[model samples]
Target: MKSSTIRTFTTVHTWTGLLAGFALFIAFYAGAITMFHDPIDTWALPKQELADARVMDKAGAMMADIVAKHPAARESIGVTYAAGHPSHEVAAYWMEKNGTWMTQAIDDAGAHDAEDHEHGLADFVYELHYDLGIPEIGIYLMGIVSVIYGVALLTGVLIHLPNLVRELFALRPGHNLKRLWQDAHNVIGILSLPFHIIFAVTGALLCLTLVALMAFNVAIFDGKLMSAFERMTSALPDTAAMTAAGPGADAKTNVPMLPPAELGAIARKAALGAGATNFDPDYMRYVHYGQPGAAAEVRGTSEKTLGEYGMVALDASTGRIINMQLTGARDANHATYSAIFGLHFGTFGSLSLRWLYFILGLAGAFLFYSGNLLYIETRRKRRNAEQPMKVRAMATATVGVCIGTCLAISVTFIANHLAPYFGAEPTLVVQPVCFITFFAAVAWTFWRRPAKAAVDLLWATAVASVLVGVLDMALHGDRLVRTLAEGRYDVLGVDLVAMAMGVGFGWLAVATRRRAVEGDPCSVWAARSPRVTATTTPAHDG
Candidate 1:
């Protein structure tokens, strides 16, 4: 790139990064933990110790009983037969536009099986990471930010290239403030280039799918394309235009539907027949149950990454599969959509792939952190406090927001466990509290001493969050001992992690305190700022 272009890119990268750094930091941190979503789920909702339970009765028999009991659910689907809790099995949409669904888990005689379902903490954490602990919309917004972030990344690289050769791993320790930040930012960016690119492309596709469709429409379809796309993607039973009927048949608005277990079995068999490797019917659907041609569909995923992967929908009466083409299936539209989904969610790979993404994500977060520090530090020597008021204001806001994000996340974990007992829904209460508190912290610290605020907040986060874990251990009931002695790793695993977090927090508190004691404004980048009035490091306090 030309020198001018590089400078332009650098400016874009720095500003964009600074703007999004705080949100991205929390996102990346939570995302890293979400990598082990399943394990975490298991840890929070430990297995019921009833794995050996048997499916006593046949699916068909139980399904019969369900239908007989709930006669109105006659147009119902299949059955799910399991003695113990199993991965969701059975497809059943509970729409009563036509009829009610009464799918029952059954033993051999077709009676209902007893099982329990509980929302677990791991799922909460998963939500927190992606959605800023918000509801569904958070995911889409994050995706939008990711797209803007990609633009910033490209620009940043362009600007940094001019000095890339001059400062490869360049950490000028003493008397050089800017060099420390510049080195930190540049190195992490280069190291995680591949990861950043992957996220950028995927994130763009996710957030801009609507835009993409619009472009395609104006360019090729002339604003009319849904019909053709649907035709290519799936086999819709009725494509013909129906003439207006003189009068609709006297219709019952609500009718009882088939039993869930039998509906699941039918859906599972169809899915298996459709060549899905693991045909487990989960979350069944029943549309217009008890009405003429009522449909029952089962949706699921298979091991195949880019092949036929969705569940098969079976005609509840005839047991004929109605539809099965998923995005993974080979078709122009489906393949493209599947790839987009895989890229956005990191679903294309397993735990290892997720870990790689997580590490790169954190590196990306670090990139922004360093970018802010670089901006402030570069002006430190040349510009006094009377430097452009706007520049000073921007730097203060950046530091407060960026550091404040770290503190907020620390608060999230603490609030999660405590909010429940405070007569509040933990996820609802904790997420907003952490975010609002964080915003308040940033605004308050802007005019007050920024450096001191940053240090104090970090310490507070370390203490508050770390203490949550300690409290959990101290208050454990008999369940804790039982879990440990039984060699069940779920509960034990989380306990261990909590303990580790406490230790990590304590360590950070120590390190930052030492930096303050030693008169350094920045803890990690000690050479940049002169020490505080104190001579000793936090390590050597009274």
Candidate 2:
């Protein structure tokens, strides 16, 4: 490549990476945790189990209670089952008069509002991965960021491809800090190029689908884009037949309804027989539950398929399958649509695939981290000269947002464990606790030097991670032992991962402190002037 072309690509890579780096950092880190979302939910929430003999009885009762108290729910009620260490109990949910949602959990004691614990942590983390926790616009913003990331990825590969063969594995360990960092960054980026590409494409397409539809509506379809798309995607052959009265409307009839378990069984048989390799009925949605025209929709996850979830709609009164959208029945467009989610979330495979994604996701987070560090290192001034203001700001943000996010998440875990003792709802405390800790850490970074703040926040994250894991295990030691003996690894895995994170963060904190103390005096990371030498000898920390 020509020198001028190299410079152009480098500029594009730098600017694009800088623009999207922090958001991608949060996304990657949170996404890594979300890879084990079910396990985390199992670890965090109280487990409830009903005997096989009584499970159907409890579900039926729960469904009946929901319809009796909230007649509006009879129009469209969903019964979500409690499958294998469910984060929550078997419950029914529907929209209320004010448009808010209401839920009723199964109560063994026959009491109202038995929904005690809320496993919102996993969901919140997953939201952070996609939206940075912003409501309406955040996802769109990340979509734009993802587009920029793709450009960065392209230019980055362009810059490195020329030297790929000779320097791919040439990770020189000594003195020249920039070369070492670049070497590591290049290796990871090159080796994981495919992973990053999947994210860049899927993230953009998923988040911007609505935006694209709107654009196409105005530009090409003459306002028929959404209608056309809906017509194509509708599961029901006759969409009008599936329509029902809005919330707060009364049911057309007061006839008896079939048991939930029976409907679930019918739906399950329909889905599996339609070519789903594995189906576990998780949710059943009923329209006009007690009416002659009542219908049911059952949705569940399927194993070892690109389309991870399959659904069957039934005529509830007769247990007759009305429509099936299982893997074998899906058309090309629908299969592709479903596969997007499965590919992005690794839901098409077993536990081993999830573990692989988790590791790669964390490495993706480190890629952005290292990108920020490279920016700071490249812009450093001479040994005796003052560092640039932009360099300082980037360093501060890199430490504050990246490290602070980790600290906040760890602290939120601790808060979740302790919320019940204080008579607080765990779900209610999640957002406030997370944002407060995050902003405080950011404020601390601004108050202190970046070098010192990085060490402080990392150490804090380490301690909190360790405390949440070890202390929780201590409180539930007997249960842990029993579960271990019983071959249940969900809770044990979460606790162990937490402790491992602590160890990782602790090591980072010590390494960063060491780099700060002994690095070049003019380097932004250097805490103070070195007594041993005046010569510039930069040190790096990753």
Candidate 3:
């Protein structure tokens, strides 16, 4: 490439990265934690009682009771089976006309209210990953950010192509801080290039689905794309469409319905016959329950497949398989969509793959962090004078949004542990607690100098993380011992991980404090005055 071309690419890379770095940092950091979503939920929430032999009967009763109380819910309602995980409560879900869902556990003592489904720690962390804790517009905003991130990735590769081989592993951490940061950023970015690209592509596609659908409808489908698209993705016949024309569609019937266990067994057999190696049905949605036209859609996860999830639809009244779309039997379009989710979430492989993804996610977060550091270092004032306003602003933002996010999430974990003691539901307070801690930490970051705030927040995060482990032990010691005796490790893993993160944060705090106080007198990270003696050595440029 020409010198001007390289410069153009470099500028593009820099601007795009700066534009998307903070959001990507939050996404990656939270996303890493979400890799262990089930385990984390298990660790933070109280366990549900083990299901009895009559659990299937209870599920069936719950479904019937829901439709009995609210006839309108006969249109569509879903019930999730526990599948041996107490955290996976057997719950019923129905959407209200106003576009909100109501959930009720099968074990509830009385009639359930129209309360919205309560999200656990894993789901909330995932919201931070994709939505940045914002609802409605956040996903779309992140879609645009993902586009810019893709551009940054391309331009970055272009700008570094010439020197990539030579500087790929260069890590000179001497007097040239800029050189050190640059080398570290390059190393991580290059190593995680594929992972970043996968996220960029899939994230944009997932988040911008509506936009793409609109564009495609106008451009190629002549405005008839949605129906076809829906059919392609969901092989099952639309219940609303069926209800309009099928037998007994206009009225409810008094016919006895098949047992929930039998429906699940039929779905499981269908999935296995359709080539899923192993299928565990966890969710089933009923449409027109107790009627001749009733249908049930059972969805489950499959092991050892590109499509980690598969669905089997059945006639609810007679237990006849109406449609089957398992991992191996899916059509091209449905398989493609399922594969996207599997690849994006590392759900197609073993637990080890999830762990690998977790490590990569944390590394990706660090990659963006180091990119910001490189930007600040590259712009640092060299003459032992006050730093530029833009430089300071970037430093403040880097500390606030990045490190503050860490502290906020750690505090959120603490809040999760503490909520039960006050007789509050953790699910109800998780969102409020996360948002509050996040905004407060950001305000604190802006209130103090960037370097000082970074160290302070790091320590806070360390303390908060340690407290998560401490509280888990202090509050649930007896339960933890009992669980361990039974060979359950999820809760133990979470506690250990929390304490480990605390140690990491503590080390970072000490290191940051040392650098702010003693590393460089003229840098933005320095706590001392910018003035230097005449005989001071000049900083080296890489």
Query: Considering every candidate listed, which one attains the maximal TM-score?
Result: 3
Candidate 1 accuracy as TM-score = 0.71
Q: Candidate 2: list runs displaced more than 4 Å.
A: 47-75, 96-104, 109-119, 217-234, 242-251, 254-256, 288-292, 529-542
Per-residue lDDT for 269 in model 1?
69
Candidate 1 — worst ten consecutive residues by lDDT sum? 241-250
Better structure of 1 and 2 per lDDT: 2
lDDT of each: 0.55, 0.80, 0.83
Task: Identify the candidate with maximal lDDT.
Answer: 3
Q: Tell me model 3's lDDT, rounded to 2 decimals.
A: 0.83
Candidate 2 lDDT by residue in tens digits, 339-449: 888888888888999998999899999999999888987887655435789999999999999999999999988887788889987778887899999999999999997
The CA lDDT at 240 in model 1 is: 27
Candidate 3's TM-score: 0.94
Clash totals for all models, in order? 35, 0, 0
TM-score, one value per model: 0.71, 0.89, 0.94
- Root-mean-square deviation of candidate 1: 7.5
